[model samples]
Target: MSLHEVHKSHRVGWLRAAVLGANDGIVSTASLIIGVAAAGAAKDNILLAGVAGLVAGAMSMAAGEYVSVSSQSDTERADLAIEKKSLEENIEFEIDELTQIYEERGLEPNLAKEVAKQLMAYDALGAHARDEIGISQTAGARPVQAALYSAGTFTIGAALPLVVAWAIPGDHLIKTVAASSLVFLALLGGLAARAGGASIAIGAIRVTFWGALAMALTAGVGRAFGVVA
Candidate 1:
C-alpha cells in the first residue's frame, strides 16, 4: 500500500491559483452587491454595482497576479542565467558541487559522484537547478498565462452572484442572494477540495461559513447605514 499519495501535476499550482481567485471573486463581489442593494439602492443601481464589481475585480486579479508572478519569473530567469554562466565557466566545479551534494544526502561518495557525473553530462544546468536552486523547467512561472487564468476564473465566479441578482425579484433579492451565494461557495469549495485531494465536507463548510459571515456583516452594515442615510 502507498504510504501517502501526492498528485504530481505540473498544473496543480495553476489550478490552485485559479480556484483561489475565483473563490475570492465570488465571496467579495456577492457581499458587495448584497450590502449595496440592502442599502435600498435601485435595481439598476444594484446591477450597475455588480457589473462594475465584476469587471474591476477581474482586472485587479489579472494585474496583481501578473505583476507578482512576473517578479518571480524575473528572479527565476536571473537565477537560470547565473547558473548557466557558472556551468559554462566552471563546469568541473559545478560537477564536483553536485557530487558533494548527493554525497551529503547519505549516498556513498564514489556512487554519488558517478550519479552526479552522469546526470550532469546529460543536463548540467537542469540537474543543478532542480537539486540546488530548487526550480524546475516544468514549474517555471508565466506572467501572461497567470494573468489570463486569474481574470477568466474571477469572471466566472463573479457571474454566479450576478445570476442570482437577475433571477430573484426585488422583494426576495436578499434571501435569494444570501442562499445562492452560500450554495455557490459550497460548490466551489467542494470542487477545489476534490482537486487537491482534501475533505470536501470541510472545504464546503469552511467556505460557506466565511461567506455567510461576510454576507451577514454586510447586511448589518447596510441596514445600519441605510437608517443613518
Candidate 2:
C-alpha cells in the first residue's frame, strides 16, 4: 500500500496576502460607506465614497504587497548569493556545516556526513539553501504572485459591500451596509481559516471583531462631525 500526506505550509505566502487583502477590502469599504451615511451624506455621495475606497484600497494592497515581498525576495537572493560564494570558496566547511545541521536533527555523525556529501555532490547550492539557510523553492517569495493575489482578492472583497450599498435605498442604508458587511467579514474569515486549515469560528470572530470596531469608530466620528456641522 502507498501512503499520501497533505500539508498546508506551501499555501502560506499567497494565502496570507489573499486573506489580508480580502479582509481589508470588506472592512474599509464598508466602514467608509457607513461613516459617510451616518454623517447624513446623500445616497449618491455614499456610493461614490464606497467606489473610491474600493479602488484606492485595492491599489494600496497591490503596491504594499509587491514592495514588501520584493524586499523579502531581494534578501533571499542576497543570502543565496552569499551562500553560493561560501560554498565555492569553502566547500569542506559547507559540507561540515550541513553535516552538523543534520546531526543536530538526530542523525548519526558519520551518516550525516555521508548524506551531506551525497547531497552536495548532487546539488551543492541547493543543499545549502534548504538545510543551511532554511530557504526552499516551495516557500520562496514571489513578488508578482503576491501582488496579483492581494489586488485580486481585495477587489472581490471590496465589491461585495459596495454592491450592497448600491442596491439598498435610503433610511436603512447604514444599518443594511453594516450588517451585511459584518456577515461578509465573518464569511471571509471562515473561508480563509478553512483554506489555511485553522479554526473557522476563531477566524470568523477575530475578523468580525476588528471590522465592527473600525465601523463603529468611523461612524461615531462621522456622526459627531455631522452634528457639529
Please name the candidate that would achieve the greatest TM-score relative to the true structure. Answer: 2
Give the local distance difference test score of model 2. 0.93
TM-score, structure 2 vs. true:
0.96
| Best prediction by lDDT | 2
lDDT of 1 by residue, 1-229 (tens): 8897666466665876688688878887888889988899887888889899999999999999999989999998899899999999998899889989999999999999899999998999889999989898667888888888889999999999988898888788888888988999999899888877789999899989999999899988888897336
**lDDT, candidates in the order shown:** 0.87, 0.93
List all candidate RMSDs to the true structure.
Answer: 2.8, 1.4
* lDDT score at residue 145, model 1, on the 0-100 scale: 83
Q: Give lDDT tens digits, candidate 2, residues 1-229.
A: 5596777889999999999999999999999998898899988998999999999999999999999999999999999999999988999999999999999999999999999999999999999999988899889999999999999999999999899999998788888989999999999999989988999999999999999999999999889887435
